[model samples]
Target chain A: MYYRSQYPRDLFAELDRLQREMQEAFDFSPSIRGLARGSFPAINVGGTPSSVDIYAFAPGLDPASIDVQLEKGTLTVAGERKAAEVPEKSTVHINERFGGAFRRVITLPDDVDSESIDAKYRDGLLHIAIQRKQEAQPRRIAIK
Target chain B: MNMNESTQVAKAAEAARNEAAMLPPVDVIEDTGGITLYADLPGVPKDKLSLQVEAGTLTIEGEVALDVPQGMEATHAEVSLPRYRRVFTLSKELDTQKVNAEFNQGLLKLRIPKAEHAKPRRIEVKLT
Candidate 1:
């Protein structure tokens, strides 16, 4: 099975070109480093002998809104945060906090086993655990 | 669950907002090398807070509001913008002496430059 749209003979290639342009624009991370603008969530990465740990820091964000997935050695985090209501009578002097939607995508090392990833959210932090496959584990070799 | 705790926190937050004249809360993020912080000071002027990194800890203490807004009264307040208080433990890989901070657009951006060797670098793949 494949996902490709076929167009009329005259517009076949042109439509394909347009689709490519749209894909490029819609792609989450276009940069080589994969960093995007607007409120990048903080992340902490640690690894044990058998697994790698990743944590994302996001306050005031509901856990239900968070989406985490691991595929092709890339860890993706997508979520939205709504603005808190401020009463009409309250006069505001300073408004610095940003409210809206935020999405962050990170690329992981090749050693991670995509299917074996596990995750949990707590205390405004999303913790993800990816266990390494046996072949990817570190092993000491004896000299002859 | 954090969500359940947040409700209780919300109540406490509301109370704190009523008690304090201002709440200058700061969100902090730290990595293996250094720490970055975002402090929300709605009415705090440039001259209020002095940013300094001494030894291995960052100190951000500042006064938020000298006087309440001219024509405003606190009723059912939820935003507890207090005096900004945030502390961060810096890693040894950070050069605390050269830390820099700037406040613009109501957001304080602090750049604690990391040591040269602490940054990630690519290693060449060679074939023998």
Candidate 2:
């Protein structure tokens, strides 16, 4: 079974590499722009019968700087991560964190109630909850 | 490849990928006082963070906890829930004893002070 899985895994990796090479060949700019696509803050969206929840993984952000906007059924979270101040006359060894303006958009289900949306930031994570419309919720039918 | 060999190879590849993925991005700044390191570890609470210095090496580990409501199904997920880990070698010129760390909103800030000998000194001229 393990041997069988390896073949497909290798094939997938080969295809992925080829796709990346083709992208590079067609585009002169770097594939990952600062805080773009793969580099943007990641998010998770889940829903229950009552409400929809969104968890955004954004560390090193000032909660006050974060901006949340809802339009139609789309929710956008925008913020800027400021760069740390490096003292003068000091040599920098490594820097991997990307800092700049970032905007993440999530489309909520049509059943969500925009007026009942709430968001909070804590411990470097942003939580957004939107209540589901009462009519859209699942209901149990009664037998006569 | 045999089943056993293939399993071993797959395990090795998985381990390598996890190591790469868990490496949290960091920014190291050096000043006259010492060097400061900043690491971005999202979703890690203060209590779940660990920092230690042993044998001139500094290690930072943060566990990210995701709270999912019960009976809820995830429809879309782009973020991964992986613990953050990173290590740095401290030079002898740094005063490890005076090292201090502060965490706020998922950012870890470490301040390592410079030893007396590492600081710049001025020599006073004596009248002949």
Candidate 3:
């Protein structure tokens, strides 16, 4: 899904490729990261002893319009944000908000239990939690 | 059900205190009636969001709340900050008193109507 087309592409797409290359060369910290022109929605994935948490930040979307699916330890979040209406004779100044179909795929760690997953959308963020299997959980051992 | 509300609130507060502010994406449109501004602020609830206008300046701020489980460690993370802040200069011709705003699904829309004098007026022709 991250692959680019071989044929002609838009100027924005070429710029995105350049941005990706810069990111690779100088892995900037997310705390002060710059805009990623290619990716529609930003996501964060983390895990604990019990479960793993995934968050997708995509605003201006209806909860029902989103589709969350997990198969073979790969989680995919897909959704679309309808474009805002621009009245006739109106002048647009800045348009940085994303408006289109977006999809993000992430592979979970081996400890995660694929079946035990819960996903919810609220406050323009999608949160997904997946439990880890019993054997995969960390346990303290007694030194006797 | 597993985590308590108070603990989550405390965690959110701590996160907000430690994190740095990031600029949120926005769209601005102008029409005859008013100017409409759309800001994307995911993970920020209504209660945590604030809009302020002072001395011809508008400020948008919100603290994002991240719900981390009891003792979860982050194996991977893209963004850990929970604060978003942006300031804009308000035009003198805009009617700040009548500014209207609406928030839905972490998106904020603000409309600043044109001042009465700033609006276009049609004058009647005098017949002698």
Candidate 4:
């Protein structure tokens, strides 16, 4: 059953890539500007024996402005990025940076303890650590 | 062929390699004073960043650091750790000597002032 469901998911992903490529081919502006439709605030999630760590890449954001929350085995990072203000009498040649409110939700493993979670933002990256529950930890068994 | 042509070709090849790694998004704004460039380069620290200008060409490079936890494997991975690099050609009217740079939260800001001759000036009226 698992192998059967995997085929269609891979096919759907391939089709989505094709559609995006076709859109880029038709739209000459993005190609000329060399811009790709990349997602905002890219993230990496990994875990250790006792805890799970999530790293979010978000530049040009104030650390104090970001809000992190965990509930129901889901972690959410929300924040706003302000647009750069152009000076008076200055003409803008090219404007490409996007600024606005953004929120990213990540579903964590059920073994994580809801009470032992810590989050910190530093050097344009947000790091979140969630401890695993005591019951979920590995134990050594002795041979008789 | 001269040395300049060979160097140009080498630069182009380096740019191609950079694009394959990661292309950092940028915004260029021109004002009366000069041009301001803003680039989004997350996960890159100040020490790992590089900025260079030569023969009216500006280049930026940054290395991203990824710290995975010890003894843990990633079951689901989406983000790829790639270095950031980009280049831009500048006009002769801009003064490279007066350029300024600042990095905060992995965002790079470059300010290039316009040359004196390129700036606007008002001539005083004289009676004959």
- Candidate 3: residue pairs that collide: none
Tens digits of per-residue lDDT, candidate 4, A112-134, equal 99999888776687888899999
Record all residue pairs in model 2 with backbone atoms less than 3 Å apart, i.e. clashing. Answer: none
Cand. 3 TM to true fold: 0.77
Q: Give interface RMSD (Å), model 4.
A: 6.7
Clashing pairs in 1: A94-B42, B22-B81, B22-B82, B23-B81, B23-B82, B24-B82
Best-to-worst ranking by TM-score: 3, 4, 2, 1
**Clash counts for the predictions, in order:** 6, 0, 0, 0
- Candidate 1 lDDT tens digits, B5-120: 98998999677434423333454555544545555443345677656677777766555432322333332112233355555677788877667787642356675767878865
Proportion of native contacts kept per candidate: 0.01, 0.80, 0.75, 0.67
Residue-level lDDT of model 4, residues B1-94, one tens digit each, is 7999999999997775545345676778888889999988788889989899989999898888766577877754334535777779999999
Instruction: Score every model by TM-score.
Output: 0.41, 0.75, 0.77, 0.76
Q: For candidate 1, lDDT tens digit of each residue in A1-144?
A: 012211111244446645754575576534575323224354556667677776565555566778887777788888875543444433333334556776766778788788788776643446677777889877898999
lDDT of 3 at A38: 39
CA lDDT for candidate 2? 0.77
Q: Name model 1 segments beyond 4 Å from true.
A: A1-38, A141-144, B1-84, B87-128
Better of 2 and 3 by lDDT: 3
TM-score of chain A of each: 0.67, 0.71, 0.72, 0.69
lDDT by residue (B13-127, candidate 2, tens digit) is 5784465335677889888888889887888999999898999999888788877678999876545435777778889999999999999988889999999899978899999
